[model samples]
Target: MTSARRTVHGTTIGIIVLDTAFERLPGDIAHAETWPFPVQFRVVRGVRPADVIEGDASLALAAFHEAIDDLVSLGARAITTSCGFLAAVQDELTRYSPVPFFASALLQIPLIERSLPAGRRVGLVVSDANALQERHFRNVGAEPGLPIAELPADGPIRANMRDNAQQVDRAAQERDALETVERLLAAHPDVGAIVLECANLPPYSDAIARRFGLPVYDIVTLVTWLHNALVPPRYRV
Candidate 1:
């Protein structure tokens, strides 16, 4: 048991990804190139995109726990999921996790809000506005009524993501993303920072920040923070 505790080494972060067939771009969490450090990924096979997003994740709890145990044995010290909507299962999964677990980028909402000046609030850009509920926020300890924007599922970009298309139109995705941000800003001008609730949305983060000049947060930022904490940079002091 001792010798087999860790079959791998030097990898600190383990990612739990859903069964997705969609194209994962360079900034997407599931894309290995997205991370600067090494990470181990365990896909909870048979768990589909719509199942986790629109349906209850309770049915997949057993599979999730199994994945956690598997990753831990593989030398992963921290774990995170590829889906942002999985925040609904945050408490349950964190308790079951052997290591620190971050269920969603939405978890950063509270801390980001606290950092904001008065009258300003952190805005959210989620994959499906209609599917996100109050419980997802409560599970992650974020305010329930915060301003949120959604990339309309009816649009070609989000539809492909929801349906898990093997390929995606990058140009159309970018245009839709910027338009979504425009709508969000129009509705709530007091939005201080924007948080992307879709793991695949990170590719457009830089574009959002460049156009709106607001700080954007996503799975990449969350994972990087977790990795840095687990493996701090060495300094010759």
Candidate 2:
């Protein structure tokens, strides 16, 4: 007698969600309706935003592993997370996943670096500069010396994410984002493009791009590229 094997039929991507209670705008990865293709989501219950930003691997690794098992069993061709800050434990997650896993949008940093001209840089907008350390960059194979800016500590944007507020002020968030980008460009005038390190920021990507006149990269762009690779479209040429 042959043993039965479990399989998921159509889903190509699985997303491990953090235990958050904030409003997820359209472009944010946590919003299930954001993806065009069908996806499976498993909330790593108890894994909060602070845990992803500053907690030790031991705090979240077990939940991540369990989520990977669930997603893989469901036939997910690739796995990704809803939080970009999880880049801190990416190596551990990759070690546990049987399929391709993109733990953070920061994973695209190295590829972005390759596109830059000599002396030009990529500006990084993160949730908190204090939480993003040297190891986070190293985990994603990104070089050091990348200029970074953080969301204002006292702004509505940070309030929504860090405090897990029930409401988000889009107008206020855009104001803070635009101001931050301007400061970043002023400080690092040679920045060729901007990379948003927080997955929740993509909803405002266009606004930032219009204000700064630079390309913006975020989790949506990275995951879309990865999804294309996992399930390439067939064209009758």
Candidate 3:
């Protein structure tokens, strides 16, 4: 019989991650580990941005599709990609896959917007502002030109976060992220909710919420919701 045909008390959710050497940046992996349901992972090798401006999405989709097939074979009930940029092909990916799939954390934008009153808006904290465009915003049912903020993943800022992930300077990384969120909120007072664009930032979700006094949404939360609905704990064996 097929893997999908086999029933278990719990269901597995597959996460497709980027091919990066960084081990501590496994936000998706960490999220899956903490999930209430069973989780499986399938990595796609060697997919990265070249010039920052020029992205090879075709290569990304190829890796993603291959990973999906493997996960389905392993009996994954649903799939979620690790990065927000993957939303570019979310519609296509979901259409092609037999299982439920979520491509981006920004998918929560529409729900967030609907929950809030007018004048108050959701803010996006992205690793790369230039890469986030109207296409991504609209995909999640967010208005174009919504309050968005970006912090480049470079310089001492990124270095601090990276070092913290390695356990070299945890305090420094926390401080840097806190400062960045403070600055972002100062710049956009009307932002009622915050969406963390970088998967790495979700670790500081509590900090961000406390500092800004707003609901914070990240890829982790999005995956958790999808996992719960698509693969409930009772369904896992």
Worst 10 residues of 2 by lDDT: 2-11
The runs of at least 3 residues in candidate 3 whose Cα sits more than 4 Å from the true structure, single-residue gaps closed, are 1-11, 25-32, 49-54, 155-168, 231-237
On the 0 to 100 scale, the lDDT of residue 175 in model 1 is 85
How would you encode candidate 1's per-residue C-alpha lDDT over 132-199 as one tens digit per residue?
99899999887788888899878766788777888899878888888999999999999999999998
Candidate 1 matches the true fold with a TM-score of 0.96
Per-candidate TM-score against the hidden true structure: 0.96, 0.94, 0.83
How many clashing pairs per prediction, in order? 0, 0, 7
Residues 26-55, candidate 3, lDDT per residue (tens digit)?
Answer: 343444545556777666776643312147
Question: By the TM-score metric, which is better: model 1 or model 3?
Answer: 1
* Highest-scoring model, lDDT: 1
Task: Give candidate 2's total backbone clashes.
Answer: 0
lDDT score of model 3? 0.70
For candidate 2, the per-residue lDDT at 116 reads 84
- Top TM-score prediction, candidate number: 1
Model 2 quality (TM-score): 0.94
Better of 1 and 3 by lDDT: 1
For residues 1-237, write the lDDT of model 2, one tens digit per residue. Answer: 963376767888999998988898888898877899988989998888887787775577888999999998888889999888888888888888999999998998888888988988888998899988888888999877789888888888888877888988878888888888888898889999999988888888999988878899999999899999988899998
